[model samples]
Target: MRRDATSSARARIGAALLLLLSGSVVAAGEGDWPAFGRDPSNGHHSPLTTIDRSNVARLRPTWIFQSGVTGYFQAEPVIVEGVMYVSTTGNHVAALDAKTGRVLWTYTHKARTEKIFGPPSNRGVAVSEGLVFEATMDGRVIALDAKTGRLVWDQEAVRPEEGETETASALAATLGDKPVQGSSRLGFKMPPLVAEGLVIVGVTGAGYGLHVEDEKGGLDGGSVVGIEGGYGRRGWLAAYDAKTGAERWRWYVTKEDGWEGVFAETTPDGIPLNRDIAAEKAAAEKNRDAWKVGGGSLWMTPAYDPALGLIFLGTGNPAPQNFGLTRPGDNLYTMSLVALDVRTGQLRWHFQQVPHEQWGYDVASPPFLVEATTPDGQVKAVAQASKTGFIYLHERTTGRLLARSEPLITHKNLFAPPSPEGTVVSPGPLGAISWHPVAYDAVSNRAFAQVRHGAATYTIKTVPASGNRPELRYTETSEAKGEPTFSTLTAIDLASGKAVWSKKAGSRLSGGTLSTAGGLVFSGEEDGHLDAHDAGTGEILWRFQCGAGIGGPPVTYAVDGRQYVAVAAGGASFTKASGFGTGDALVVFALPD
Candidate 1:
C-alpha cells in the first residue's frame, strides 16, 4: 500500500527510483519544465523547492505573458534553459524568456481550416534537439527551430477520411445545428511525448458524434447524441522523427482481429456490465466490418519507461458515441491502458477499463509511472486516472493490476442503461477527472485529483423511420438540468487506497493538479483562482486570482537560483454557461527576492 518515507529517507528512495525509472524518459532538469507532465513519466511533480511550504505565502506574480490568440489554453508550456516555448490554442508557437516574459519569437502554424474534427485546440508542443514540434488540429505534425521559432520541417501525419463531412452533418443533425456547427472530430489535441529521438503524438476526436457546441462557441454544455450508423475514423498513436518530421511508427488503437474477444460481460476489474451478451453476439456477426470505423481516440501524452522500452497511454471511447447495440463485440483497445513497444508501435499489453462501454467512460486521463510497494516487494507501476473515478495502478512490466486508488468522486446508477424516460448517471461523459491530469507524491504515498461534481441525465429517443431513414434509437446524454456544480481537489492515499482529504476547489476546476517537492498542491478554478493546498492535509496555503479560467496545468521551474510557477488563463472555450472564465494569459509567480 503506502511506502511512507519521510525527509532524508524519502529523498534517498525517490532519487533511487528516479534513476531506475528513467528509461527513455526525459528527466526534466530541476529548473526546466521540459516536457508535459514535467517529464516523460507524466509525473507533474517538480523537483524544484525554493518556494516551499515556508515561503509559499509570499509567492507573487513575477511576470505575465499574453498570447493574444485566445481560446481554451490547454497547452502546457515547455521550458528549456531560460527560454519558454508555448503552443497557442490556435497551433501557433511562441518563444519567450522564461525569466522576464519577453517575447523572443513566434512561429505561426498554417492549419487547414476546413473538414477538421471538432473545434481546434493544440494542447502543447515537444522540444528536443534544438527543435520545437507540435501536432496540429488539422491532422499534421511540424517541427520548428527552438531558438528562432522558424519552421524547420512539416509533414502530414493523417488526412481526413472521405465522407467525414457528411458524417459530421449526420451526427450534428441530432442536436439541430447549422452545418458549420457540426464538429470536426479527427485531429490532435495532446502535447507530444518526445523520447528516444522520436516525437510521439496521438489523434483525438476520432470518437464520432457531434460533441454539441454551445452559444459560447465551445463544444460543451449540450448533450452528446449518437445516431445509428457507422461514422467514425480509426484512432491511432504515431511516432515521427523529431528532426525531419519523418514517420517512424504508427499504432492503431483498435485492433483488427480479436476485437470481439468473447464479448466480455463484465469489466476487467470484475464489475458486471449488465451486458446483453446474446444480442451483442448477433449484432457482431451482422456488423463484422465495424472495426473499420472503430473509434479509439488517443488524446493524452503517453508515459514512457526507457528501461522497459515501453510507453503507456489510455484510449478514449469507441465511435458512434456510446450506444452499445451499434458496434458489437468487446471493441479491443479502446477505453484501456495500453503499453506499447516504443520503437515498434506494437502492443505489448493492455488493460481495458470499460469493455463494450456504453457509459462514455473513456480512459481520458494520461497514465504515469511510479514506484510502489506490492505484496512481493518494491515494483515499478504505471497508473492512470479514469473518467469512472479511480486511479488504476498496475505492475510496470506485466500490466497486471496492483491496486485502484479510492474514488475521486461519487457514483450513482453506474452501468445502468439509459431508459426511455431517462436514467441519471452521476459521472456522465464528463468524468470526475475530465482529461485533467492527477498529481502524485511518492514520498507521501498520495495522489491528488482535481475532480468535478455533477451528473448527467441520459434520455433515450427512439425514432421510427420516415422514408429513406431507418428506425433508430440513441442516447442523448446531457448535463443534468438543475444540478448545481462545483469542483474539489481530493488527495488519495496510495498506501491505504482511500481518500485522505478533499478541499472545495471553486465553482468548477479548469485544469489538473500540480504538486511540488515543496509539499504543495496547486490547481485552477473556473472562477479564475489558482490555489495551492498543503499536500499532506489538503489545506489552502495560498491563492491568486488569474481573472481568467486557469485552463492548463500548473508548472514550476527555476531560473538563476529562483523558482517560478506558471499557468495559463483563458476563459474556457466550452462551459461558459457553466461560468468558467476565458482569456489569453500565462501568469508566472515566485517569491520576492
Candidate 2:
C-alpha cells in the first residue's frame, strides 16, 4: 500500500531536519544507506569507525547474494531498517535481509520488446516513506512495498506521443530499414531521488543511438549513426507526488530558444573553448529549430541541500554525441552542473564545465557537497569530479568558482576537435572519472576520486542521408589506441587545491570510492578486488578478491551493531572492453564476530 500523504510529508520534514542537524543531506543513519550517495549530500561517507583502519584486514565475507540475472551490475544497494533493496540489470528489484543477505522478495518489470539504446544497466533504487522506488528501463517509476516487495503504484513517467510508433514505423518503411528509434528511447538508468514529498527522476538515451563499432565490438573508437531528419530527443528531470505518483513539475534540460547562448568563446571558468562563433551564428539561422531535439541527458541523481533548498546534478553530453556541425553554438545546460529549486524545479543557476562540447565529454559523475574553508572563510560548496580530469568546486548558493583541483590524470590535446584523419585525446570520452561516485572526507578536508589514464583517436566522416531532407551527415569514430590504461586513486585537498597523495592500481577502477570516519577509503577494481586505502595517505591497507569485477560503488552500513561494507560485483562494458571478466554477486564484508 502507498504511504499516507500526511505521513509522507511528515517523513520528509523529519528527513530535512535530520539533514540540517547532522550537517549531511542524506537521511542515512549509522545503520542504513537509505539513498544513493548514502544521503542528499552525496558524501558517500560513513560515520561508523568500528571497522577502522587498525582492524580492516580482519574483514571477511559475511554473506553473498547472487542475482541469477546479470549484465552490468552497477546498482548501489540501499538499506532501510535492515532490509536491503537492490535493482538488477533487467530492472529486477529484490529486497533482502540486510544481516544475512537472504532474499525477502523480488519484483521484476516486464521486458520491453522494442530495441533500447545503451547498455542494459541500473545504477540503484531509492527508499522513502515505506516504499522502495525504482526507475525501469521502459520509462516507468514503480513504487513497491518495502516489506513484502508488493506493487504499490506504477507511474508511466514518459508516454510515447500519439502516432509516435506509426511515425517510426513509416520512417523505417520508407528507408527499408529497422524502425527509427525516437528520442523517447526513454528509460531511467539512474537511482530515484525522493525528497519534499516528491519522487525525483530523469530519463537518459536522448543523446544515444545506433553506433558503428570497430571489429573489437567496443565503443571506445566508435561512431554514432542515425536517421536523416532530426533524430535526437529532449532530456528532462521531473518530480512526482510520492504518495500517489502524480506529476508535480518538470524541467527540460534543453532550452526552447537561446540554447546556443551567446556563442561563448570560452568556458565560464575562462578555458578556451576552440569554437567557431561566427560560423555557429551563421549556422544558427538555418538550424533554428535544433533545440527541439537538443540532447542533454541527466546521468546521475542530484545532491540536495535542505537548508538552501537547491538540488545539484551533472548533465550528459549534448545530442548527436560527437557530430557538432549540425548543432551549433554552446549547448547550454549540457555538460554542466545545474542547481535547481527543489520545490519548484526552477533553475537557480548552472556552471557549464565545457561549452559547445564536441569531444563527448559528459559531466557524468554525481556532485558531492562539502563545507570548505575558502579565502572568504568557511562556505558550503559543491564538488564534481569532472570528465575533464579536474575536481571543480563551486559555491553552492551563488555558483561561484571556489577552487579546481589539478588534473587528476593525463591531459593531452584536452579539447582538440575531430578531424577527417584523427586527433588523439587523453581522458577519452569514457572520462578521467566516469559515472562512478567520489567520496568526501570532511575530517581531512580531502576528496578521493578514481580516474582512468587512457586516450582515444577521433576521426570524422560525412555521409549522405536518404530521407526527404536528404541532408549531409557528419559522424565521428572514436578508436581506442594509446598507452596501456591504468587506474589511480587521488586524494585532493579541498583547501589547497592540490593532490595530497596518489596511488595507482594495475586495472581500471570501475566502481567508486567510499570513505569512513574509520580512517579508510574503499574502491572496487575491474580485476574483481575491493581495496581499502588509508584515508589520509594513499596506501593499500586491505584487499578482497570477489569472483567478478566490482563495477558499482562500495557502500558501508551496519546492522545490529555490526559494521558491514557491501558492493555489487558484476561486470561492466568497460571491464569487458578492457579484458576483465564480470560477476553477479552482492558481496558483504564484515569484521569477524
Candidate 3:
C-alpha cells in the first residue's frame, strides 16, 4: 500500500483486540512483554500479584522461545490481554500465547547480510488498535497487523535529499588568499515512542561513517536531522499520525549555519567558495562528497506520562564513539533528558549531563517516572536515574531540577566541576543506567536502580585527510583500556536524594532492577543468578539459578489471584562480546501457596 493510503484502511482497526479478563488483566499471562517497559511510565512495575513473596520460592520454569538470531535480545515483551508480542533478531515480530508460550504468528524482515553494521537485536514492540509497531536495525518503521502478524507497511525513515547540506575539508579555500573550513551532512535510528494517536521519534546521525562524496571531490561529516530542539536538519521532533502517516509538526534545535573542514591543493590561496550551510558559509566550502552512514543509534525506548502530559526520552552520544573535537558545544540533548509535549512536539525542558561527550554516556535508559513525597513533608515529585551515574529528581509538573545522587566510585584523574547551579559528574559511559528499565515503589517513595562502577580510558588522534573522506579526523586511543570494577543496586529516597540502602552485586556489568509492594526487589547478576532482595533494607532474601545468565528486566503479575515473577535470562548483547549465554528463555518463578 502507498504511504498516503495506509491511513484510510479501516480494516486495521479490527486487528486491535481489547481483551477483557477478570484476573490481573492478563498482562503477565505469557512471555509477551507488551509496550516498552510494560507501560509508558517506564516503571517496569507490574500489578499482577499471582506470584507473591510467600510462595515465590516454588516458582519453576514454564517454557522457552528460540529467536534463531543472535546479538542482543535487550527488548522486553509486551503482553496485551492474553496475547504477547515480541521482537527477535532480523527484525522479526512474533505473537505468542501468554499461557503456554506458544508462537501464534510471526513476521520477519531479512536485513542485508554482507554489511558490517551492528548486530541485529530488538529492544521491544508497541501495539495499538489493530497494528503493531517496530523499528529495524537498518532504520525502517514497520507496521504489522496485530492479530495475524502480517505486514501492513514498512517505510524507510532516513533519506536525505541531495544537495541539502555539505561538510568541511583540510587546508583552506581562500577569498583571494587565506585559509577556510568545511560544513556538516547528516540521517536516523531512534526507536520511536507512540501515544495520543502519534509516534514521537528522534534521529542519530552527524557522527562518523555517515559521510557522502561531496561535489568538491573530498568527503565531509554531518549532523543529526530530526531532533526538534537543535540544528542540522533542524534536529526535528516529528509526530506522524498513527492511522494516516501524515507529518504533524517539527521543532528545530538551532538556526546557526554549520561548518566544514577546509584544505588547499596548490598555491597560497583557494577559491572563495561558500558552503550552502545557512551560516558560516564564506569561511568554508561544504564537502558535499562521499560520506559513510550508521552509528550512535537511539537503541532504547522512551517513557510516557499521560497524567503529566509529557514524553521523556534520552539520546545517544555523539558519533565516532570515543573522540571529541570534531563535534563541540555540549552537543546539546545528545546525553541529555528531554521532556516533550505529547501533542505538540514542543520542548518543555532539557538537562544535558555530559557536554561534548568523549565517552559513550548515552542517556538511553527508559525514563522511569516515580511519583513520591519529599522530606520537607509537603513536596510530591517525579524522579529518574541517568546512565551518566546520577539520580535526578525533578518537579514532574514543571521539569525543575531538584537534586542528583552521584555513584560512589573511585576515579583516577576525572574531574567534572558542578555547574554553578548543580554539580557536574561522570556516571561512566555505560551509563550509571542503560536500556534496562528500573523499578519504582510508591509505598516506600524509593526508586531502585542498577549500575556499573568503573573507568573507560580512551584518547583521539587526527589522521591525514585523503580520498572522499572529510579532513576532520577521529581515532580512539586503544592503549587506554577499561578497568573491571564492582556493581550494585541502590535505593534512593526521592525527597532528599539520599542513598537509603544498597546491595553490592558481583560486577559493574549486570542486569536491570525491579521492586514490588510484596516487599521484594528482583534483579540479576553477571555471574548468572537471579536474586530477590528486600525492597526496603536491601537484604538478599532468595535467588534462583537460571540456565543462562540474567541480563533483562524481571516482571511480576497475578494470575487467578496467585503472584508470579518472570525474567529474561538471555545475557548481555551490545556490551559483552559473545562468550556469555544467549539463550532465548523466559524463566517464570512463583512461591508455594
Candidate 4:
C-alpha cells in the first residue's frame, strides 16, 4: 500500500512521541523481569502482591532446573513473555518455560581456554525485541534468538594485550604454571543492557591480577605463593548496535588527559579525604601517563533514565587496587557513579564516592533510580549502596547529594594507610555491601541492602628492583582475619536517611535482594538458604534450603496469574572461602499450585 508523504511523516512523529512517553514511565510489569535489575531503574522491586506476608510462608519449591555446570552461579534469571532466560557459569545461556522450568534450549559459547582473571561467572542477561543479550566472561557480547536460543551475533568487546597476557602468565606461574590458574584474566562479569536499539556492556578485571596469593599459604586455599606486581590494563565501557554487532562508541573508564582531576582535600560532600596532596602533586610529573593502564573496571549493569536520556553506572578501584602508589590524584571517574548520554556516550556528570581510593572500595553495585523528596521538594534521584557501608542518594539531574544513609555495618580504620606491620581494618575489600543489588520499596520509600562485617590485615611490602626487574615495586596484601565475620539485612528509609530496621545473619550475605508489594523482601546467604523477611520490620517470615549457597540476585515474575520467585543456587568464591557447599541449580518457588 502506498501512502502520502505528509501522512507518513505524521505517523512517524506520533510513534516517536509514544516511545518518548513510554520511556519516561516506570513501565516494568508484574509478569516480566526483562533486564538485570528487572527494569531500567534497577529498582529490583515488583508490584505483585499475590503471595503477601500472610501467604508467603506457604511458598514451596515448584520447579528446580539443574544446569549441571557448577562453579559460582550468580546469574539473575530474566523473564520476558512466558520464558525465563538465565546465563550460567562458562557463559552458557538457556531459555526455560517460566511456569514449568522446562529447558527450551541452550546456547553454550566455546569460551577461551586461556588464562583469565576472576571466575567463570556471569551476573545475568537482558531481553529486548525478541533477542537475548549476554556479556561473557571471555570478553564477548553475544545475542541470541529469544525463543529458540539460536546465536544471532557475537562481538568481541575486549581484546587481550600482550602485557595483560604476560601478567596473567606471571600470576599463574607462581601456582606451578597451571593453565586454569593463568586463564585470560580480563573480561566481563556483569550482564549486558539493551537500550534504544543499543547493547551497552562494560568490561571488568582491568584492576585485577596485581596480587594473587596461593591457598597453601592460607591464601588461594593455601595452595599457591602470592604474586604481586604493578600489572593491570585499562578498563572501558562500549556501546554496540543491537541488531548488528557493530561498535557505536566507546568510553574508557580511565582517561588519558585530566585523569588527575582536581586534587581536592575533601570529598564532594565535605568529608576529609586524608590525602597527601603535596606528595601526589610532586609525583604527578613523573607518572603523567599512568592513566593508560590505570585500572577502573566497570563491574555492574547500568541504570537508564529515558526521561533524562542518561545511563548511570559505577566503576571499580584504580589499578594496582590496594597498592595505588603509582597512580595519584582523584582518579576522576573511578569509584564513582557516572551518568552518561545514552545515545552519545558522553559524560553528563559523576559523583565519586571514594576519591583517590586506597581502600579497595569499588562502587561495585548497580545504581538505582528513584523519586526522592528533599528539603526543597521531590526530585528525580539515584541511589547506590557503597562498600563503605552507606547508601548514598543524589539528585539525578545535577548529581547533588540529597542524603546518605547511616552506616549499616561497622566501620573501623576506614582510611588507614597500609603499613609494614599489618593494620586491622573492618569492612575490608569484600565490602559491607558487595556487588549484590539492593531492593527498593517505593511504597515505604525504603532501600534494602545486604551488609557484611569482617576485618582484614592490610600490610605493604617494598620489593627492590634486581637483575631482571626494571623498577622498584610496592606490594599490598589484605589477608582475611578470624575476627568474627557476620552479615546484616538493613532497610534504610531514603526519605529520612535512617535505617528503619536491621536483621543480623550468621554468615556473610551473598546474593542481592528483591522487595515486593507482598510485604516481603527475598534474599540469600553464604549458606544454602533463601529466606523471606517482613518488609516493614526485619523478621524472618519463611525460609527454604536450595542445596547450595544463593550467591546471586533473587527475582520475581508472574506466569499467567501465578507468582514465582527464582534465584541461582551455586556457591561463589566468597562463599567457598567461608566454607560453604556448592551446586548448580536454578530454583523457582511459588504458592501451592
Candidate 5:
C-alpha cells in the first residue's frame, strides 16, 4: 500500500540468495533396491508385493537382458526407481528397466590377466544420492551416475608401494631370514559400501607393500589410509567422502613395529603364552595380506542398520585355507560377523563361527536383522545361517549371543582339537548358507534359509619356494565327503528360537528363498525345477520344471496389480564341483489367472 520501498525489496532478494547459495538439498526418500539387501536391515522382504502368489503361475517373461557377463550369476538384481542393476564375473554391470528388463546402460571393467582362483562374481550394486557404485577385480572403486552409465570417478583401491607391509614366499635358502624378494606386488578386491556420507571399502588381498622386518616384528606396519586403522596396507577399511571421493579415515588389523608395545597394554597376562607371543604375533601379522594369495575376501554386500548407526558385514575364509596348521589363532574378523559403528568405522564387536576353518567355510552370506514377536514379547536381533552348519541369532544392540542351531548332522575333524579361534570350521566349504539370500515372513515371524548339508575334506601341500617364501604354504582340495545329497529349507521361529519345520529339497543346489503373502515359499531347485511350498507346513504346493536350471534367488513383484514370481535360472558358475552347466534365463511365473 505504501510507495515502492527499495530496502524491503532488497531484503527479500537477499533472503532468496541465501537459500540458493546454501544449496544444501535433501536426498530423495523414494524406496528402491539401492543395495543387495534392499535396505540396511538385510531384510530381503519388500513391501511391493504387487505380484502375489495368487496369479504367479500365469506370469511370463516380459523381457530379458543378457549381461554378457557370464559365470555364477549369484548377484541379486537391484532396482532403483525403474532401473535394475546387476554384475557378473570380470566386471560387467548392466542397468535395465525394472518393468521391461530393457537395457538402459552398461559398464564393463577390464579383468586382470591372472584372473584365476575364483571366477569374477559380484553380488550387486550400491546406490547413494545419485551415484551407483561398483568395485572391480583390477582393484578399483568406480562411481557412476545412476541415471546414466557415465563414470564419475575411480580410485586405485590398493597398490604395491615401497616399504609397505606384505606377505610372500621366498627361495628355500632365504627361509632362514625374512621374506624379502627382489620383486614385489600387491592386490585387493571387494565392493565398497556407502553409508552416512562415507564410502566404506575393504581389501581382499595383500595390502600394497613389502614385508620388511620392523622392531615389533615382520614388516611391522604399512600405510593403511582410513578406517580399520592399522600400519600395513592390507586388510584395511578405508573411508572416503561420498561426494568428493576423498580419503577421510583408515584402520588396519595390525600395527607397525614400534607399535608392538600397544598390545602389551591390552593382552591378558593370565593366558599362558611362549614369551611375548602377543607382541610377536602382532609383528608377524603386520605383513599378512590376503588379496595377493586369496585369503579373506569380502565378497558379499554388507548390511547396515541406520537406526543403530552400525554396519554389519560378514568376511570370507582364511588364506591357504586348506592348511589350518600354518596360520594359527582365530583370525580376527575372518569367517565372522563384524559390527562397526557407522560414523567412526570402529569395531564394536565380532562373532567368529569356524575358527581355523579348513574347508573354506566363510561367513560370507548376509546377516538378517529380524524384528519379531518373541514368546514373551517382541525383540530385534541379528540372524544368520553359517556354512558351518549353524543358524546363529544374536542381540543386535550388544552382539550378545542369543541362540544358534545345528541344522545338519556334521562331523568334526577327529585329527584336530577344537580349532584355534580363526582357522576354519565348516559344514561345507562355502557355507550352510553362502551368497544365497534368505527371506523373512512378517506374518509368521519366521526366517526361511536354504542350506547344503554335507562335509568337505581339506589338506595342505608345500609348494617350492622360488622367490621369497613365507614360513610355510598350504594346498587344499575339497569334495562332498558324506551326505544324502539333499538341500533343506528351514523355517526358524524367532520367538522360540527353534526350527518350526524343515523340508528336504530335491536337489542340493537350491538357490535362495522367497516368501509370499499367498501362504507360499518359493525356491529354485538345483535339479532345474521351481517349486512353491506351503509356508506354514513346508509342503510342496506346486512344481514347474523350467527349461534351464535355477541358481538365483527368486523375487516377487507385481505388474498391473497381478502378482508375479521371478528368478534368474542361470546355473551355478565359479565352482566346477557342482557339475552344473550355465543356463541363461530369468523365469517369471504367475498363478492361474
Candidate 6:
C-alpha cells in the first residue's frame, strides 16, 4: 500500500479496545505489555488492578531471569500471550515464559563489527505480526520468529562506523590520549517501533561528543573537545518494510536549509538564552559547511498517533554537544519535540527547547500522548518531562504549547554560556532527566518523572599551538564535588501544570516509572530497591532489594488471572563512581497464588 493513501487505514488505533464485560465497557489487553510503552500512546500505564494499593504490600518475588550480561540493564520486557521478550546490553534477546521463569529461546547477536560506534545498551524489543524486531548495537536490524528464536531477515540499516576510529584516533593523539577501539562508533539505544507494516528505527551517537571514562574526563574530553570541524554525522529516522526489510521513507533530523534559523535569543516559551548572536553569525560564515554534520540523534522511544498519522519523539542536542559555534542557528530540529508524519517521514511540526544548544539540554525523556482538557474541552495532547526541568504540554495536532509545568528539579544557571575558567550550572549535560521514561495515569491526570540533581562546571580551555597542531580552544566540564546533589520522583498534575506531590528517593533514582490502575506507581533506585509508590499520595508502599540498581522500567502483566510486576536490576544505575553494586537479574514480583 502507498504510504500517503493507505497510511491511516494501516495504522492501529492505540486507544483501548473496549470490550463489554459484565455489562460495563472495559478496556482489554491490560493483561499484557506488547510494546516498550505498552501501546502507541507510550503512556506506560497498565489498567490491571489486581495488585492495587491494598494488596500490593503482599507482593513478593516469584521468579528471577538472570540475563548474565554485565553493565547497564535497561530492558523493558515485552509480554504477549504469556511470553516475555526482552533485550539486554550486548545485543542479546530472549524469550521467556511469563508464568514461570523458563527461558524458551535466546538469540545471541553476531555483530557485523565488534566496534560499537554508539551506546551498546539495547532497551527492549518490539513484537508485531509474529515477528520480534531488534535494533542491534552494531548497526543492523534483525527480525526473529516470534514463536521460535529463528532468524527471519537481517538488514544493515545504518551505515557502518565509517571513519569513526580514524576520528577518535586523531582526537586522542591530539590530546595525548589513547583511543579506545570499540568506543569509536555508534548503535541503536532503543528498540524499533513497528507500526503500519513498517519498522521505524533511529541511530544513536551520531553526535561528535565522545563519551568520557571518568567525571574529570567528561569535562575535558566528553563534550568539550569538538574538533575536526565535521566530525559528527547527521542523524536520521527511517522506516522499512516489516517483512522484507525494504526501505520505505527516511527523514534527516537537521534542516537542509543550513540549520541556522533566526538566531532566536529565547526558547519557544520566551526564556532568555545565553548566546552571542554577532559572534555566532561571524563564526557561521567561517565554518559554512558545519551544517552537513549537524548533531541531532534520536535518543528515546516515540509515541505514534493513529488519529494524526504522526510520530512524536525527542531529539538529542546538536553535535559537538556542549560547544556552540560550529552548527549555529537554533540547530533547527535538535533538542526539540518533533512530530513527523509516520507514513512519509515528513516533518509535521517541531518545538525546540534550546536554540544554539550549549548546555546539552536535550528533550531527552520520551514524550507520551494524552487527552488533555483545554479551553476547547478535550483535545489530544503530547507531554514531555524535559532536561530543562519542566513538563511541557503541547496540543498534539498543531504542536501548540498548552502548558509548561513548574521545574521538577532545581535550576540555577540555565542556558548560561561556557566560561573560560568555569561556570557552574545546575541541570547540566547529565541532565535533570537523562533518557528516563516518565509514566502517566489518565485516571488522575498525573505524570511521574525521575529527576537527578547535579551540577557541572563548563570551562573553555585553550591549548596553545604546538609544533604541528593548530591552536585549539574548546568548552569542557568538570565534576563539581563541592556542590551537593540528589534525585527525586516527582508527580505533576497535568491539568493545572503543578506538582501535586514529590518524594525524595532513598537512593539515586536512576530508573523510570510505571503506573497501573491499582493506584500504584512502580520505580527503582541505584541502591537495588524496586519500590511501589501510592499514585495519589506519593508514598512508598512496598520495597524490594534486588541486589542491583534498578535502572529499567518495571512492567506489570497478568498470567492466569494473576498479576505480576517485573523489573531488571543491573548494577550501578548512575555510574561506576557511585559504587552501586552491579548484577543482571530480571526480578518478577507477584502475590502468592
Give stretches of model 6 more than 4 Å off.
1-28, 163-167, 174-184, 215-225, 572-574
Q: Give one digit per residue, the lDDT tens place, for model 6 in 208-236.
A: 45544554322222333454356666778
Off by over 4 Å in 4: 1-29, 160-184, 210-230, 470-472, 480-482, 574-576
Which residue pairs show backbone clashes in model 6? 117-185, 117-186, 118-185, 118-186, 118-187, 219-477, 224-475, 295-319, 571-582
List residue ranges in candidate 2 displaced over 4 A. Answer: 1-27, 112-114, 160-184, 221-229, 464-471, 574-576
How much is 485 displaced in model 2, in angstroms? 2.3
lDDT of each: 0.79, 0.78, 0.53, 0.78, 0.55, 0.78
> Residue by residue across 488-585, what tens digits does model 1's lDDT show?
88998876688999888656776788998788999988778899898888888999999788778888888898999999887644654656557889
Per-prediction TM-score: 0.94, 0.91, 0.73, 0.91, 0.73, 0.92
lDDT of 2 by residue, 1-593 (tens): 13333442443454446554433334555577778987788888876777887999999999999888766899999988798899987889999999999889998768543455466789999888788888877788889998888899988876533113222343334433222323337678899888787889988887753555445555444444433236567888999888888889999988887888877788777778777777878878788787777778888899998778889998887766666756788877788999999889999998989977877788889998888787678998999999889999899998988888887887888777777788787877777888889998776789999988887766765444555534344444455565557789889998888889988896778778999878899998887899999998888989998878887899988999999999999885632355667667899999998
Ranking by TM-score: 1, 6, 4, 2, 5, 3
User: The CA-based lDDT of model 6 is what?
Assistant: 0.78
Evaluate model 1: give its lDDT: 0.79
Residues 1-593, model 4: lDDT tens digits: 13333442443343234334423221345476767877777888876677888999999999998998986899999887788899998889999999999889999778764545666788988887778888887788888998788899999776644235454453443335322332225688888877778889988887754434444322333221122334566778999888898999998888788989999787776767678888889888887877877778888888888778888999998876666557778887788999989898998889988888777788998999888998788888999999988888888887888888888777777777666787677777778887999998765899998888877766765444546754343444455567767789999999888889989976667889999877899989878889999998889999998888887999988989999999999885532355677789999999996
lDDT of 6 at 371: 79
Better of 5 and 6 by TM-score: 6
Per-residue error at 556 for model 1, in Å? 0.3
Compared with the true structure, the alpha-carbon lDDT of candidate 5 equals 0.55
RMSD versus native structure for model 5: 12.0
Per-model clash counts, in order, read: 17, 5, 80, 18, 56, 9
TM-score of 3: 0.73
